[model samples]
Every structure is written in C-alpha cells, then in structure tokens.
Target: FINFPVFFSGVSMLIVVGVALDTSAQIESHLIERRYEGFLASGRLKGRYVR
Candidate 1:
C-alpha cells in the first residue's frame, strides 16, 4: 500500500520527532540546572516560559 514517497515521509517525520525530543531534553536539563523546580517534573518543562 505504501510507495517510495510515503516511506520517505514517514522516515522524515521520525527524524523530526527525534530532533525535537533531543532539543527539548537539553533545554529541560538546562532549566533544571538553573534550579527551576516544578510540579510536573516529567520533562514537560515548557511551563517555565509561562511564568
């Protein structure tokens, strides 16, 4: 059912997701190093920007 383009697209999406996760982890670690504690503590530290 899938063609070459479809397969390529899937791979591209996977790469994007991987990059986003890596970057988010780095940023979250940096935030934690700065002593920014939170209730979530689940690596979803995007909440810090809201404050």
Candidate 2:
C-alpha cells in the first residue's frame, strides 16, 4: 500500500526547491540587468555561489 503522508512530504519538498530556484533565477536576472558585476562584492553572494 502507498503511504500518502510520506509521498506528500516528498512532493512538498520538491515544490519548495522549485520555488526557490525560480526566485533565485529572477533575482539573478534582475542583478544582471542592473549592469553590476554579478555580485562579486564583499559579503555579497551570487545565484551560482549560493547554489
């Protein structure tokens, strides 16, 4: 028999990860479009770096 609670937990985690990826991508695009140095400043982290 299938464990519905466990399946739902796994799916929720995936959803969270997907949302995080999308949000980070949007942030990265905004930063790039601003004509900056891709977050190379002190204590500043880029999308790739955060990943």
Candidate 3:
C-alpha cells in the first residue's frame, strides 16, 4: 500500500505541472498572436492549428 503523504504529494505535483503547462501555453499563444517570439529562443512554439 502507498503511504498517504506520498500519494498526495504525487497528486499535488501533477496538478502543479498541469497548471504550469497550461499557463505557459496561454502565454506562448498570446505572444505568437502578437507577432512576438515564444518562451524558447530557438524558434516559435507550434500550436495544434498554427505553425
């Protein structure tokens, strides 16, 4: 059986990662829409419907 604290910790990490990803994507999209570079310096981030 898993320890209670360990299980909750894992779940908390997952939530944190999910929120971070979502927020970054939103920011990236906004930047791209305004004809600015993305968070990465290499190139623009590709979206599902846009380049």
Which candidate gets the maximum TM-score versus the true structure?
2
Alpha-carbon runs more than 4 Å astray in model 2: 1-8, 36-51
In lDDT terms, how accurate is model 1?
Answer: 0.77
Q: How close is candidate 2 to the true structure, as a TM-score?
A: 0.53
* Residue 4 lDDT, candidate 2, scale 0-100: 70
Rank by TM-score, descending? 2, 3, 1
The worst-scoring run of ten residues by lDDT in candidate 3 lies at 36-45
Off by over 4 Å in 3: 1-8, 36-51
Q: How accurate locally, in lDDT, is each candidate?
A: 0.77, 0.75, 0.75
lDDT of 3: 0.75
lDDT by residue (tens digit), candidate 1, 1-51: 755665578779889899999999999998887765553565666647653
Decide which is better by TM-score, 1 or 2: 2
Cα lDDT tens digits, model 2, 1-51, are 665765578779889899999999999998786656544454475454663
